[model samples]
Target: MKKYKDFVCVGFAFALSTVSCEAKNDAKIHVSQLGYTPNSDKKAMVVPDGKVDSFYLCDAASGKICYRGKLSPKKYWDLSGEDLQWADFSSYDKSGEYYLSVGGKKSYNFTISSKAYDDLTLWAHKTFYLWRCGIDCTEEFSNFHGQSYAHKAGHPDVNVIVHPSAESAGRKAGSTVKSPGGWYDAGDYGKYTVNSAIALESMLMSAEAFPSFYKNFDMEIPESTNNTVDVLDEAMYNLEWMLTLIDTVDGCVAHKVTTKRFVPMVLPAETNVQRYMIGKSTATNYGFAAIMAKASRLYKNNPDYPDFSEKAMRYAKRAYEWAEKNPGIIFHNPDSIGTGSYTARFPEQFRFWADVELYLATKDKKYIDLTAIDTFQYDVPTWQLPASFALMSLIVGVENNMVDGDLKKKTELHFDKLANLLYDRMEKDPGRFPLFKFEWGSNGGLANAGTILLLQYKKTGDKKYLKAAQDITTYMIGRNATGYCFVTGFGQKSPMFIHDRRSTGDGIAVPVPGLLAGGPTLDAIRDCDTYVYNYDHPKSEYPTREYPARAYNDEICSYSTNEVAINWSAPFLMLLAGINENSK
Candidate 1:
């Protein structure tokens, strides 16, 4: 397994020359890589350090100024810790290739078209195949990363070994169990149940929210040839693996499957390392139940997969029962394990999600009564807290007249409050972005926030909520402090060295498309020591000021800033789906 210490020397080697002068100049004016929809409000970010007082939109080919505008009044951004201004181009509705010019510097070329995000939506869905595990990623399917025939030597995981890092009650070393097939969790090779559950829920919700959009959409995965909805087919590839985590004998589920240490950045086929099933916990079991219950409904009417719904419901019921019996169990990674902890201190949200989903699936009053629906707070769903999954399910139930009137009214009130709060916050923010806290995976947080706002737009028919959601997507592409598209292969100046093991080692010039990087971390808590020792050349090499949002670096060595994860990409897909649906 790889250690953090191994990268110290490598970090030092690249630190001095990583941030180029060109990037510094480009940071002055940041515009979206995908540009703006023809009729939507368009905006660009102008850093405080820049001297530009006004901006102009010029044709990319002709270099003729089409429109000019003054910068918005400066407002302090809590996340970026900087006073930033915006250049609004909302009135420019002509469809053309254009660039933003502030002072004498020209921003990256972008497009203003009706179908701005059409290709992006397809590419985002294809990203899942790139992150797939348990199979070879052939050149035919992968444009970058070439071909990696991985895990050929590995067995079916029919008898999972319990490593010392995962010792627990009813689980001993060399214990035989069946657990197999799932997508790799992140830049690493670990397969985490908590993260997988959230990603699956995102896909499921995307399907539920925009059935017509994803119904005939082609993901171009191996299962696309099958007579089934491509979105559900892609989700099933991961769901099948998640099913293996369930210990049918006892109804508990393993938290994750990983080696004892972080593996080196190598092709999956070359690693050939032994993997183990880690500790079992109520959180994992309940999350599994919630996702499976949702899956049961999604696949219930599918003619291609006849038994999928029944099997999912049976497993969900069993897992929910087990969680009820062991409600407080939390899996803390043993000291020996050096992978992601994915620990959840509170499992109530997980329980609530499972109950609501099960009720939706079975229409059982018992499940609804157990949900305690009114007490639960609605928020954007994350791996740690998944109350949004329950909220989403309930919203769907109310729409279908499956939920009680009193509970439906309460849920609607919560949605109204959240929607208004998010819209008001976005209106007040200098950049019109809806986030206040900039942490690891902050890009994902922004995307999830957009999902929440879009949900409210559906419930309330508010265009402001929809516009706020679109603003979050714009912020991600290039309208932020870093001035680079956080996704790997989209923008003119996008991430090239994201902290994905395969992308780093695959000998590919470009990383996979649509993989969202964990954006700026304000405190620099995880990678500060390495940065200080290696990149703090004369204290001026790195960005001098400690701005909350400006803390991002696009280097591969900066894992805190540029690591790509499934959880991040999932919500991004949701945001994309929302945009696509609304655009049409």
Candidate 2:
């Protein structure tokens, strides 16, 4: 079997002649990428086309062999479309620069260090500060990619045109409301209730899971100097904005606060378009309820803002009542609106999550009775569908002995099944990538899957689960197809031209640091013109050679492939946090 693995040069490559070969065989080996963590499970791909059964890891400094390893065959993958093998270097635990050699071929230089993901983790958390809406990004705050007067002057959000999908007796075309202060949804400037719920909850969960790690952590945002913890302060900023979205009269939350169409690529302050409270739905209300309930618990009796918890509880109760009365209401973007729809086909999950949060916060038996855990799906968390968020919250509740006996058993059983399934899939995978499906923001799925595996490892004390989780992170920095580091401003060959409006329009040399590009998507929905090869074919048609995993282009126009999103960046941040804390 002749196996071919994808390999791209990272800036420069070492001279092949520099590595002296002891074996006389003509076969050679290849590696997926050029980096690995010292404490994580480390492995390099061995191209199956070669007859090299074994290879030696040599120290880069002295050219002395550190450890020799036999190659193990892995299952064939559709991405490579060929059988490949992996050289397990998990047993090698020394921190140094090293390379693998087979016959005359030498793999790229890789570093094994404890601080591998430290800088990236810090930058990932700071990305939220950059994404903060309705704030002036001063030079001191923004550093290199500074832009002043950025969305600082927000409107009163009165006299807005309410879409027909959201039209009610009280909310007419010329309705008056107040909504401000939330992070932009994605590459575009939009604040959505559903998306904000996921982003905020994920960060809060990160804080909960790793309290000691985040205790002294400073995001360097405007609120960093405050007496409150920086993560809580940041979440509070969005929580405040979310609170204003809910109508005090009916407890209905607007779907989004956005313009009729996406503004041109320019500085935030340059664009002066009127933003509107677009629509309201049960999904939005339920999401708002869940987030506020969670916030109520996080902010209760805190050093800063002692009254925030009571206010949040009141808002949460109001939203929950609204959801109870107006269940199953879905919001479709009105015909006139050209912004993101953010439509939720299934609002039941949102309701369940809300019930769980409210139950945990208030310890009210009524909130617990409304939950339907049997229908909940335990998978990696995402913004669009957030059953996993509720599941994770319940798991944490059980660990803290906050959940009752019945609920705790159900949560544990669900987690055990999910962990077993994930472990089995990883064990059978040829590439060892957690997610089998490659879609928009697939890297986020990879990271979230790693988070789940890490949780399982923490619970079961199984080294295999921990190793699998580490493998996923290793794949992100540099590994597998495409060979580009999905994150900007790190690694030798990372995304230079991401589909970000600020980075594209800003006159800066590089895009904002710590932004994770939506990795390869099988469906490149937007910006088809940039992919000239698919001109004659259908809009959805891509070349046969363009493997799903390899179908990525680091161009400004490839929005489907190269776009940076908050939902995608959130899990990556959590994964980095897990790795950082666990490595310690």
By lDDT, who's the top model here? 1
Q: Tell how far residue 161 is off in model 2, in angstroms.
A: 5.5
Per-residue lDDT of model 2, residues 431-537, tens digit only: 66566577678887887888788777767778788888787876777666555678887775688877676776666657778898988777764465753321121
lDDT of 1 by residue, 1-584 (tens): 11111111113554321221222135667888888897676888876555657666776765666666787767777666677777878777778887877766778889988788877777778788877776766556555334332222232455567875444555666776566667888888888999999999888888888776786788767888888878788889889888877767778778888877887877676676677888778888899999999999989878888988999999999889888998798888887788898998769889888988988888787876533766766555678878876787677667667777677887777767666766777787665756556767888888888988888777777777777787788889888877878877788778887777787666767776778999877546446346422221132223523765777766666677778998888888988898878754
TM-score of 1: 0.89
RMSD of 1: 9.7
Where model 2 places Cα greater than 4 Å from the true spot, the runs are: 1-34, 46-49, 61-64, 102-108, 144-171, 369-371, 530-546
TM-score of each: 0.89, 0.87
**Local error of candidate 1 at 372, Å?**
2.6
List where candidate 1 sits over 4 angstroms from the true fold. Answer: 1-25, 48-53, 144-159, 164-172, 526-545
